[model samples]
Structures are given as C-alpha cells and as structure tokens.
Target: MRAAIGVWRWRRNPLRRTTDLVEAWVALVAVALLVLAVPAAGWISGTRTDASLQRAVQAQTRQRPVTTARVVRLAEAPAPGTQSPESAGEQPARRAVVATWSAPDGTTRTGTVATRRELSDPGDTFRLWTDLDGRPVTAPMRPETAHAHATIVGLLTAALAAVFVEAARRLVVRRLTHRRYRRLDRAWAEAGPDWGRTGAGS
Candidate 1:
C-alpha cells in the first residue's frame, strides 16, 4: 500500500513536464499489461494447438483398419474389477477422461469421459479423441498445455520498453540544460560591463 502511494506520488512529479509524466504513465501501463497477458495467451495457444493435434490423430485413426466399432455413452467410472463368483467382493473405480468432438451439424461438444470404464448407458454420447500421431490416446488436456511459465524474456521485453520510454524523456532535460547554459554564457560575457569596470555600463 505504501508503495502504491509512493508510485502515485511519483506519477505527479512537479519536476517533470505534464507530457513527459503522461507518456511515462502510459508506457508503464502498456508494459505491465503485455507482461501479464503473454502467459495467458501462451496457455490458450498451447491448448488450441493440442486440440488440433488430437483432431489430426483421430482423422488418421479413422482411416486405419479397425477390428470392430461400437458406440457407447461416456462414463466417469473405471472398468469394473473382476469379483469371485463364490465370494461377493467387487469394487467400482472412478476415473474420467476429458473428451471433445464435432457433430454432423458442425457443433462441438466436450466433457468428461470415463477411461476403461463400463459401457455407456442409454443416451450417453461417446466420441473418440486421439493424439497427434493418429493413435487412440486419452484425454485432450496435457500436463503442460495449461501450464504458464513466466520467463526472463518476457520480463526483459517489458523492462526494455520502460527503459526506452524513460530514455525518451531525457531529451527534454537535455534541451532545457542547453538553453540554461546559453543564458549563463551570455550573462558571463556581460558581467564585467554591468559592473562598470571599464566604462562598460555607459
């Protein structure tokens, strides 16, 4: 909070021109937004690319020779464990796969589909999702597909942009200093005359 206050105060530095401060403020905001948006954009791009890869794989799998094909509803439960007929001991496991598919009408659907689970019941929609290499792969989501990592390059870009903006401001100070020096030089050349040291005042 104190830092925020300090920043707010710094934004209003009286020593700086209004235009310079405004430029600095705008550049700072733009750089900050770019830094924040890069990771999120990367995540989205990765997920989209992954989806595309799955589609390519699925298309290739469809072209391959198949032993059999069956349509069943997707489930969120694991395959049932074999139980001894003499003993009543059976347990059901739960595991889901993330699935998505396009329909005949060009509509897309995505949901959690069970992997190796029991056959789907009535009205259960089922679709296949494959990997990039045309193999019957599992879910569409990858461990790192959604993982966003901030790297040194992103930070450096923002830092460099900010530095450029600040450097632009130095030009104004340079011009002001040049004018001040010219005034001082003119005054120094007339200093003796003003003192009437050699009839200069007349």
Candidate 2:
C-alpha cells in the first residue's frame, strides 16, 4: 500500500527525478512478489516434503514390527549420576531389562532392552519394536510428526523468500540513491564557478 501511494504521489510531481519513479516501481514489484510468490513457494515446498516424509513413515512401519519380550531379570542399572532422563526414572517410563523373544527368523533372541515397566520379578512382559532381524529399533514416524516437520519447512521457506525479495529491493534502491548523489555532485560542480558572478542571473 505504501509503495502504491509513493508511485501515485510521485507520478506527476514536478520535482520528482527519474530515479524516484524507478525506485517507486521497484518497491511496488517487491510488494507484489511478497504477496503472491512467497506463499506459493512455501506451499509447494511443504507439499513435497510431506509426501516424502509420509513415504518414509510407511517404509519404516512395514520394516519394523512390534513383538512381546519376556523379562528374564532386571538389567544392571547405570550409575546414579550417569543415567539420562530417558534411561533413569522410578516411575514406569523406560527401565532396562534382560529379556528374550522370538525373532522373525524363528530363532530365540535375548538382549538388554528398554521397557516402560517396573521390573520386580522374572517373566514380566513388555512390547518391543524390532526389525526383521529381531534387532531393536526406534518407533516409526507418525503422520502427525511428518506434518509438523512439513510445517516448519514451509515456514522457513516463506521467511527466506521474503528476505530475498526485501534484500533485492534494498539493493536496487541503494544503487539509485548513489546515482542521484552523483548527478547532484555534477550539477553543483557545473554551477559553482558562476554562482557569484555579476549579472549571472540578471
């Protein structure tokens, strides 16, 4: 809006220089791009990102399966000061356990796994996610998490587009200003010597 007003006000003004008109036009173009192009870029980028992430989520889900493990005994706890929040908690969150389960290959597997249960005796069971080889793996990504990642990428892309447009506009304006200053200096130099001459204006 300000850019439009500037162009309108300078369109017919007698004192307006060529650089002023060009600057106003540049501002208007920048405003147009900011209004139209930035959102389009963000949307396109986000859509692509979401599609890719969703595909990855599907692949991970198919490759990993949940299985039940019977706890043989409580695994040795880490040192009191060395336990991370994820590994240390009195409540039922994530506690280490030595357990056994059947692998996809029909063989028995045993390892120290993390469980969200308070282990008191052997034979306690918990659900665990493992790959085809029965090696433990992290949970697959959810649709909600993919959406969140897409949103962040979209926002960053839009912000970067805006910054680029503003920077280009400022660079053009700065160059025009420098040209105007140079013209002003040349005009002063041409008229300086005759300024105080007798009958110079009469």
Candidate 3:
C-alpha cells in the first residue's frame, strides 16, 4: 500500500519519465550477465587443459594414476618460471604452491607450484618433473573445476529468467504510470466550474 502511494506520488513528477534511464538499466543488467558468464569461459579453458593432461598421464602410466593428488604441502609448478600470478604486475611471483606429492615411481617428494597461474592444490595428482640439476617441480595442468552439465544449463535458464523479469517489471511500471496520469488528467479536466455542473440551460 505504501509502495503504491509512493509510486502514485512519483507518477505526478514528470522528471522520472526518461526512457533513456530505462534503457540504461537494461543495458547494465545485460552487461552484468555478460561478465558473470566469464566463469564459463574459464571452465572451458580448464576443460581443455584437463583433457590434455589426462591423455599425457594415460600414456606414461599403466593405470590412470589418480590425476588429482592432494598436495600434502604447497608444491612448485613442474616448469621453472611457468607459474607467475603477477602477469599484470611488473615482477612475476617467484614461488608457487609449496606442496608434496608421491611420484609414479612411488617416491614421495615436496616441491613448489611456480607456474604463471594458480595450479592444483594439495592431493591433486599431477605429472611431476625434475630439472637438469635434479630440482623437483610440478605444475597443475588438469584441474577438474567444473560442475555437472545440467548446472551450466540451469545457469543459462536463470539468466534468461532474469531478463524476462526485468522486462516485465518495466512493462508493469509503464502501465501503472500511464493509468495514474490518465486519472490525474481526468480530474483536472473536470475541475472547471462548468464541468459536470447541474444542467443550467438544458
């Protein structure tokens, strides 16, 4: 009730009738939705990397070898200087996740994940490496950071619902505002002393 009265008062004010403002709001929502979809892009990239790594691991080991192993501690990336979080910054991050892993050879080793991007975590099995000098290294290539396919589809549905809801809101607001103005205009038109007066000459 209070909201209706508030809108009634607002309808009397002509300043709020800017179609440009309404269009701007729609544009803003669309832009926000676009940005929210960025995670989907990242998921795609991760999927590709995950597939490639799966193929690589399958080739070397007889068994699947449980790709994602937990890092008992932070581990360095497999390649030197491959992990640098500060791509936008002047200097790259020298150190990555310092963790431990058990190699396929059954030897447990500890290293840091010094890759460009943040790689796997503790307990994620990955392809291990060693430099010419025999320094241990590991990089998180395959990170299964994806929800079920249904979940992705559901997100798209939700996004479409939001758009329709916004459109409906705008439409309702417009009709209510138009009704308010017609009521006010009719009242003003009948305000003249001669309007609706008892028949004088009739």
The CA lDDT at 34 in model 2 is 98
lDDT of 3 by residue, 61-139 (tens): 3333432233454543443453323242623433356655556566665555443233445444444444323345333
Clashing pairs in 1: 75-114
Candidate 1 lDDT tens digits, 92-199 = 333344444543334554544443344344343344543333333333333333232223334454566556545655565566667767777898887945774666
Best candidate per lDDT, number?
2
Q: Assess each prediction's global lDDT (C-alpha) against the native.
A: 0.46, 0.83, 0.49
Candidate 1: residue 110 lDDT (0-100): 50
Tell how far residue 41 is off in model 2, in angstroms.
Answer: 1.4
Pitting candidate 2 against candidate 3, the one with the higher TM-score is 2
Each candidate structure's TM-score, on Cα atoms with residue i matched to residue i, is 0.31, 0.86, 0.29
- Candidate 2 C-alpha lDDT tens digits along 106-191: 78898877766565358888776778999877667778888899989998999999999999999999999999999999999998
- Report the candidate with higher TM-score, 1 versus 2: 2
Write the candidate numbers in order of decreasing lDDT: 2, 3, 1
CA RMSD, predictions in order: 14.7, 3.8, 13.2
